[model samples]
Target chain A: MTQQISTMTATETVIQAENVNIYYGSNLAVRNVFLDIPPRQITAFIGPSGCGKSTILRCFNRLNDLIEGFRLQGRITYHNHNLYAKDIDPVSVRRHIGMVFQKPNPFPKTIYDNVAYGPRVNNYEGNLDELVESSLRRAALWDEVKDKLGENGFSLSGGQQQRLSIARTIAVDPEVLLMDEPCSALDPIATLKIEELMKDLKEKYTIIIVTHNMQQAARVSDMTAFFNAEATAEQGGKVGYLVEFDETTKIFTQPSQEATQDYVSGRFG
Target chain B: MIPAAQPQKSVDLGDLKIDHSSRRSLFTIAMTILASACMLLTLIPLIAVLTYVFLQGFRRFNLPLLTQLPPPPGLTEGGIANAILGTLIVVGIAAIISVPFGVLAAVFLAEFGKGNPLARWVRFATNVLSGVPSIVAGVFAYGLLVKTGLTGYSAIAGGVALSVLMLPTIIRTTDEALQIVPKEVRMASVGLGASNYQTILKIVLPAAVPSIITGVTLAIARAAGETAPLIFTALNSSFWPGGVLEPISSLSVLVYNFATVPYEPQKQLAWAGALILVLMVLMTSIAARLATRQKTY
Candidate 1:
């Protein structure tokens, strides 16, 4: 019930969730929650396994609609539009808000085709070569894959495939980028490269990332939200609840809540 | 008391044991040999038939036998050229009619259908259709086409019959091929903002091309040797077909007719026709295998 609006006037809020609760059939996964994500800033959602951080992230674009028996009692707004509105289309919502999965899931296609897929589907009729090049450049992958555009996407190294997937997503020119553990399957060097890319991408797009690594959250995020699970008496089940949301520096250095402090200091998940 | 102080003398030991498992392994070897012999016995008839056909037909493998039309019963100077052409035309027509429909049906079942009840029913019906005998399909086509006076006993009718026989096989095989395409590729396409249709067209189909080709080739091979369907629909004509509406003679029907004749030359011609059919089927199967060469990097 805390309606703590931000005092900062210049930052534009791009996404907001109000009293959100997600369920799979009768199983309640995420409890009541409210969150505000600002444009051109990296917001990281970190929590222990099964705390529903990724589930909440998927709710932003309604990706959870693909699952059977998945339902939500909440309002998630992207800019001025309610994403779950009856008149809205999930495909259009996805085109505007792209997602990068945990694993590098590049299509079994040529590198060029993989990048071109998104643009073509979105009916982008501009200069394709330039679009692909710019998207790959923005993803920091153009230099590595420029010579091998004809090669299969699966032929790339795991790290490179992840970057190619990012390039594919950016080719559609989505306004918001949601990454779910984008670097968990990568090595340290690949992780560093992605972190750097995230920093550059935030200048143009709003980003919300769910990561397990606390250090990654501290290093890349501008705003951090800590989520924890609490047992619900009515349902006889554990439901994830937001513990704290603040400036990343304050959350890591001087948290307002004891739970956030415990989570950040590695005392408890 | 050191009563009967234990004897300190070393006792003699028996010789070391030798493993007898290897000796007992001979029984397994004997059983395996017997099983292999039984398998070989089962294959004897197939080998003997092939060998007999080859021995009798090799002498007829001349240019004239392939290029000339069937001669009068007393003459031995004709070939199976018209029959081959007729077979090619009918099979080509059948393929044209069936391949696209079959592949599309497969795409519906494998990609768009997912868990749709209608797709499941269609799939089940297709399995049932595949199990139906080729002669039954021929009879159905005869009843539908001949009874309607739509060029009774014509090449088109034959093509329709063959297509019906080929449809279920093509659909089932293509569905299996599309199913084998890794879900990761589909997910990647969807994640990139591609619509379901786009994902299927770009990602799912391409990855399954090899298997699809394999399936189509096998179907074609099966269609080439089908005689019952052609007998009922195309009937048998001594002359070449002028158009789709005219009856035509295929190699299978030609072989069947020639094999039943009471002449030495005709029997020889039948053997030659059989040899050509086997060769064509073999080449097709080989081509299919070649097309599916796995590419890994």
Candidate 2:
């Protein structure tokens, strides 16, 4: 749909994954997934619950490293650098690629301090006031929160807190943003606001979202990857795998794969 | 012959309301009454003890009771000033020794060692230590600090014993406070590229500070009232503490000794000492609650 605006011009591929397989201890949760994420665009992973959509997104910034049994066999390239190389530090990768969680999780702090937490940790040396103001403004939360920056972040409504969370991410000047079901915890209005914010943010940062809401993927994503789970033979357990990935319009309108088509049409049992 | 089904009467299901009086259970009433009786039983003793103690002790409340040394066998003009100072000194040192150790140990358990076998072992050890008697702690400290002739029968020795008593409670409560902090908050900090240590120091510690302080204060109050531990470690002196290295006159030991004396004045002095100790503990507890009650943001 945006072929007229910027697709005609060359844009660098920001991230690429090859032969990705995720395992939690002995369980092979996902296998043989290949994908590419583009810069200054929004890509979404859509799947049923427990289909490893979140697992894949977490792999981007290496958040899954926090889990005890989590491991992945894959080569993910970011900015032409090996993301999981021996010398590559996941911490720095996370600094460059920030994340927003499923829920609106602001710190137990004032709005101003919540936004400033990111920059302060990374040793931000510029005018912090300006950074805080601009970050909140960019996230479309400044006007609402400008009056009481000292109030607790939780005092804001759910949507506002989500925006505050976004403001915190962007303050660190991350090149990419990963969101794992950011709107699932929100009401329709709050979800709509976050969708709008995602679109606005894509002009400056590459955005990736995981959503169970197919309509959400159709609405905000430029590209969508649909994942499905099948019963494993060993213990009658289910394992998730990617089925189809394409332009959002194509996936929603006329998916080449039967599973994608059924999912998009709300006909999958 | 084929039989047709008869039409049934239309029930107004939406308007249906059962009479609750008929559904009420006598068993529920009995259980509720039993629970309330148990609760009252618990409260009655607490209230009775507190009331009796205050009534007996507050009568001796006066400026001299707090400001001067214990009077002679027949005279009742002096106070438990040295004992009060000694109690404060012992508890203060104990808190200073234990708070940092306990809080850091809790942080290690709650943050880095979560669900690890070592963490489980640490938690089990903490529970076991809490169950160890305070007099046993005094015995342990006496053997370590006094029997070894390091600082024999001194306030420092008493502090070491009190620290052992306070350590497990502080660690357990601090761990509880840190655990109450949602995992998502820690993830948020780490996702911001803060190292685990940084996340713990900047985010987790600040959020747990109020509860940590409360735990430490409660431990201090409990340590202040312990008499057996003081008898074992500090061993009680009649005069003011010469230094932290010397034997000190603590309120609990004074009460224990003077309460058994034949002299009326000594007994009265013991009562006054008990009252002062209770007030100190009460004030510490109140301060702790107030500290935790305030909203951080």
Candidate 3:
């Protein structure tokens, strides 16, 4: 573990999960998993449907707590603090670890208000105009929308709405950003734009994105974690497990594991 | 390259073409005729009611009839001003009592309820209350308010009964409206670090405003036309009500009284009052529609 930590000295680890397992009622959705997400770098989780990539991403911000009967057995530490500690507030965790969903979910409000909502709710007592402007700029949407901040968010095109959702997330100045298939609903051009924005955003915030698109994982991520499902003896059903985690270049080029090679090379999911 | 496969002769059969086009036209024509017949059926009753009301009530449509109070048994020199005023006051008070509680209840059911047993029971009770007869609500209010001498035979008692009648409507409407607010919006607010109360107030309530207003307006309109409850609670006072605790006569009660009278003039006044009541309801409904015209998204 010391050697592994020292090998990535330039980028520090921000989130560390040890033998994390998640269950919804009696059914286990995610098997024991271990992962370390580095600071100021993008980490992409790639897998087929129901491979627990999104579930793991949701666990980081405790979004899965919204589900009934959801329980977890694990130690997930953020900045050396246990995220699921009894005294820690999920609301505050979510505020610092913002999320962008697969679908573009801008609030039913004006573009300006949508961007300003986070700051206002969290009581960020700074210059709001500056905050909204900077956040929108970081999201790569300020130029196109600068003149029409008062217009309704739904008036924007799909790409713009997704960007607006990103802007809304960043407006709170979160330390870590989690995107659950943020560009799945976007066209190729929009996807490219968001990809570029993600590259830029990683300089300031750690990003963990769950994407089914393997090419996107290879192109944008510094490290890639490939996940797959394996049959469980007790449940007689497939449960998601992390198959491999390595540098993105190595994962795509010369993966150590046969499953990672097959997944990246498109032989199988 | 292989020669292109010859077209299948059977696939382009003329009989199939004719059958398809003929069936398509038949279906189209059938749908058109059905829609037209439905529209005509809906319009006929509306036109007939309007024509009948206008013809019967036009003779008594004068400024004096609107401004003056209803005449006594032998006299023929008055309007329904007091009754109209009383109706407005009673409905306004009922609306004041019902809207906040109903909206709050709906918010709880939609946002925090999550199928909890208490929320489910509250919802079930609201549904049952909605099905309860308005007169029964009047009886309930009379038992609670009049029997206890809280505000015996007063506008306050009438408003309380009407508010009960309106509560179910407002709750159901607000519930449906809040339910219609996309779940993503609430999640987004919660994601933004806003508390549950703040999310309901800033996000859920605003998104549901139009539907809530429509429901509240419909409740008010329905409450304005209620006479049985008003009769039991507000009783019929010839003089104008001085306060919420004083008994008042509403338009419906005045119409009921005048229509049952032996005089010809009173009967005409009843028709006039009916026309006015219909007009007021129509105006309110139209205003509500206009107010909610803004696009929700």
TM-score of chain A by itself in each prediction: 0.95, 0.94, 0.95
Model 1 lDDT per residue over B1-297, tens place: 233445784443322343346655777878889999999998999899889888888988899877788888887778888888899989988999899999999999997797699999999999999898999989988999976897788889999999998899889988998888766566556766677887888778877888788788888999999999999898877776678888998999999999999988888888899999888898889988986775221
TM-scores for every predicted model: 0.88, 0.92, 0.91
- Overall lDDT per candidate, in order of appearance: 0.86, 0.87, 0.87
lDDT of 2 by residue, B1-297 (tens): 222333573444532444444435566777899999999999998888778778878887888877888886777678889999999999988988999999999999998886699999999999999999899999999999999999998999999999999999999989999988888888889999898898888888888888888899899989999998889788888787799999998999999999999998888788878878888899989989987895342
- Measured on C-alpha atoms, candidate 1 has an lDDT of 0.86
lDDT of 3: 0.87
Candidate 3: where are CA atoms >4 Å away?
Answer: A1-11, A231-237, B1-46, B291-297
lDDT of 3 by residue, B95-136 (tens): 999999999999899878995999999999999999999999
Query: lDDT by residue for model 2 over A1-269, one digit each (tens)?
Result: 10111122335778877778999999999887877787898988887888888888888898889988998898888987878889989889999999999988999889999999999999999999999999999999999999999999989999899999999999999999999899888899989988998999999999999998888998999988888888888787778888887778988998778887888898873
Q: Which stretches of candidate 2 lie over 4 Å from their true place?
A: A1-11, B1-25, B291-297
Task: Supply the DockQ value of model 3.
Answer: 0.60
Which stretches in model 1 have alpha-carbon errors above 4 Å?
A1-11, A228-241, A250-269, B1-50, B294-297
Candidate numbers, best TM-score first, in rank order? 2, 3, 1
The best candidate by TM-score is 2
Candidate 2 true-interface contact recovery: 0.65
